[model samples]
Target: MASVAFGYLPILLFLLVALGLSTAFVVLPMIVSRFTGAHQPNPEKLSEYECGFPAFEDSRAQFDVRFYLVAILFIVFDLEAAFLFPWAVSLDSTGWAGWTGMMVFLAELGLGLAYAWKKGALEWE
Candidate 1:
């Protein structure tokens, strides 16, 4: 147990130092601000700004379905691209099995893209 603790001593010391440094950084600014700052509040400063126009309605309004569809499509394609990196790195080691797996993955993605295209999800018009 002593030997185990000795092995972790460097990690423990690192954690303690990190905690102390972060606390100092956070507390020092707060202490300095208390000494230097005065409270000033105005109604105009608190209000949300609109593009040169006074807000006519509630800011939280319902969005269109197209925005969600585009977001989902972007996420799907982005995740597919992320998967490609690891596959590309180990291509030689993976051989036919990995190649077949990637082909299936790509085929599924292509099908999804085709479905979205047919549904007009990809169209801006």
Candidate 2:
């Protein structure tokens, strides 16, 4: 109804104000920096900042796939733990159905881990 739509007016106004403030923050800095920022381009300033370490080699270096494999595995296990939190919280209300479902989920994760292990996904070298 008309009254229901009117109820959302405050939220709409708040959204507009939030958008305006965000735009002001982004634009104000750009404007200020454009006018007052210095334009010095010396060799030291242009050089890469590598924790006070001078450039020893090219920056375009290839990383090992072992790092990516470990990272992906960590994310998969991390998400499994994240899903377990809410399931544990409502375990009493969900009864046996919830317990069985969680068991199946864990079994699936175990299988995946086993598969990865068999494929040498967990190996560092």
Candidate 3:
């Protein structure tokens, strides 16, 4: 029981150090800014800046479907890239099975891209 408890000491120490560093990172910047007199709040400073443009229309205005389609496509492909990194890193252990799986995943993404292209989803105008 004593040896088992000791084995977790390193993990506990790591968690403590991580917690300390994270807390410092969050709190230190606010402390430094306050001491440096940069925490002042003014109307212009606190005002919202929408892409450097003033609010010209209703905030609840509906957007084009193409905008959402493009956004979804971007997220899908981004997730595919994220998965590829981990799969590639573990390729040695995963072997032929992993390679075939990744190939199939890529093929499906490619087909989706082709379908989107055919429907002019990639077009901006």
Candidate 4:
């Protein structure tokens, strides 16, 4: 039991250091800014920054379906690109199975892209 607890000492030390650093990073800046008076709030600074003007619609306004579609498509492709790097790195160890699996994944993404293009989801108008 002592050895088991000893094995976790490094992890506990790491967590302590991480907590200390994170707390210092967050609290030190506020303390420095407070003393320097660099974070003074103003009406202009507090106002909305979007569109460089006051918002015309409610903040909870509904967006078009195309907006969501585009966002989802971007996230899907972005994750697919992220997966490629790890798959490529492990390809030698994984051999033919990895290669074929990635090929299939790419093909599926290509087909989805084609389907979306055919449905005019890629069009801005």
Give the clashing residue pairs of candidate 3, or none: none
lDDT string for model 1 (1-125, tens) is 99998999999999999999999999988888677873345777667675766677787977789999999999999999999999999999999999999999999999999999999998885
- lDDT string for model 4 (1-125, tens) is 99999999999999999999999999999999999998999998889887788888998999999999999999999999999999999999999999999999999999999999999999998
Instruction: Give the lDDT of residue 73 in candidate 4.
Output: 99
Give the count of colliding residue pairs in each prediction. 0, 0, 0, 0
Off by over 4 Å in 2: 1-16, 27-63
| lDDT-better candidate, 1 vs 3 | 3
- Model 3 root mean square deviation, Cα atoms: 5.5
- RMSD in order of candidates: 5.4, 5.6, 5.5, 4.1
lDDT of each: 0.91, 0.92, 0.97, 0.96
lDDT of 3 at 81: 92
How do the residues 1-125 of candidate 3 rate in per-residue lDDT, one tens digit apiece? 99999999999999999999999999999999999999999989977786876778997999999999999999999999999999999999999999999999999999999999999999997
Q: After best superposition, candidate 2 residue 66: deviation in angstroms? A: 3.4
Cα shift from native, residue 58, model 3 (Å): 1.0
Q: Model 4 off-target regions past 4 Å? A: 1-32, 47-53
How far out, in Å, is residue 48 in model 4? 4.0
How many backbone clashes are present in model 4? 0
